[model samples]
Target: MTPELVRELIARGEALTLEFKGEERRQLSENDLVETVVCMANRPTQEMGYVLIGVEDDGRVTGARPRDAGGIDPLRIQALIANRTRPSLSCRVWVVELEGKPVLVIEVPRSCKDLCVRVRV
Candidate 1:
């Protein structure tokens, strides 16, 4: 997504379809991330859900450092979901620059199945 879109989401604040994760301060808990993905996927909406990393709950942008951004691997997230979630789910993860800061965006589509069970992290 573009920086403008990111800003818009931030302005809108967290909701059922959007979550902000401030990874610049601390690493995201694997269990929390897995559970959130499951919950968002199972939500009753046609639109996709978003997990915006490097953003705080209060709409602050801490930003993922360049080194840390390089380490934010989407494949690792996919593997975790594949192993832990029942019926399996796919997500698109990418890094977007916002005012010279890197933000990791994980986009999860609504599940076709009735539920997205989170078996484990």
Candidate 2:
């Protein structure tokens, strides 16, 4: 997504289709990441949900930590979410530079199955 869209989402605040995770102060655990993705995917509507990392609940952009040598790996994130979530959720992952910091964005589509049963992480 574009940087402007990310900003708009943050301005709109959290909702059923949007969540913000502040990974600036404390690193977000892997389990929390997976669970958030699962929750967004399970939303009742078929609309796309977004998880914006590096953004605080109050809309502060402190930025996400680099997972690799120089940046976060989108492919790695996609694989992790797919592997951890039940029904194997597939998502689009990317990074946007805002206020001189990197924000990680995970776009989760609604689950096709009845529910994400027995999701373990």
Candidate 3:
């Protein structure tokens, strides 16, 4: 995605329906990953969501996966989220190479039922 696109999402911050992480670069938190999947599994109609990683504030493209965060590991991550999240969160995780770096890309489609979001205590 372009810098402008990232800026737009960051500008909006967290949505009950969609959450975006602007800090803690290079690491995809378990919570963030789950939120994206839940959004797809039970998100509102006409809503498209995502969990964007490796994208800088300036819209610069960071690598696909960090040396510490292996590209192969994200595949495992996909399985982990699928296994644990209740009602099941089916989503696609792609390791995109941006500017010669690897970044995890997740796309979630809107869901009709089972609104998959709750405020974490």
Candidate 4:
């Protein structure tokens, strides 16, 4: 995604379709990420959901360090979600440069089924 898109998302703030996750203290836990994806996928809006990493709930951009982003394997995250959730969740995982910092974006499409649940992670 472009920096402008990321800026727009931040401007919109948290809502049914958007959520923020900051890595201020430590790396995000797999379970937390999986569960959130499930929740967003199940939302009634049926619109695409976004999980913006390195952004705080208040819209502050803490941002992920370059090394931190390098350490996060998108393929590994995708595999984890695929194996942990019931009915599975298909998502696009990518990193964008926002203000010279890495921001991970997890885009979750609305589920065709009723809901997605996290079995384990």
In TM-score terms, which candidate is top?
A: 2
Please tell me which model should have the higher TM-score, number 1 or number 4. Answer: 4
lDDT of 2 by residue, 35-120 (tens): 88888888887678999999999999999988769679989999988888777888999999999999999998988766653356
lDDT of 4 by residue, 1-121 (tens): 7889989999999999999989887767778778888888887786779988899889988885333345767677777777888788778887887877778888888887655555563
List runs of model 1 lying over 4 Å from the truth. 65-70
- Give the lowest summed-lDDT range of ten residues in model 1: 64-73
TM-score, per-candidate, Cα-based: 0.80, 0.92, 0.59, 0.86
The lDDT leader among the candidates is 2
Estimate, for each residue in 1-121, the C-alpha lDDT of model 1 and write its tens digit.
7788888888999998998888766777777677878888888878779988789889888875433355667677777766788777778877778877778778888888556555563
Evaluate all candidate structures by whole-model CA lDDT and list the values in order. 0.78, 0.88, 0.56, 0.80
RMSD of 3: 5.1
- Clashing residue pairs in candidate 3 (N, C-alpha, C atoms within 3 angstroms): 63-101, 63-102, 63-103, 64-101, 64-102, 64-103, 65-102
In angstroms, the error of model 4 at 78 is 1.6
Alpha-carbon shift of residue 16 in model 3 (angstroms): 9.4
Worst 10 residues of 2 by lDDT: 112-121
Query: Regarding lDDT, does 2 or 4 come out ahead?
Result: 2
**Reference-based TM-score, model 4:** 0.86
Ranking by lDDT: 2, 4, 1, 3
| Candidate 2: residue pairs that collide | none
Any runs in candidate 3 off by more than 4 Å, and if so which? 1-26, 36-45, 64-70, 117-121
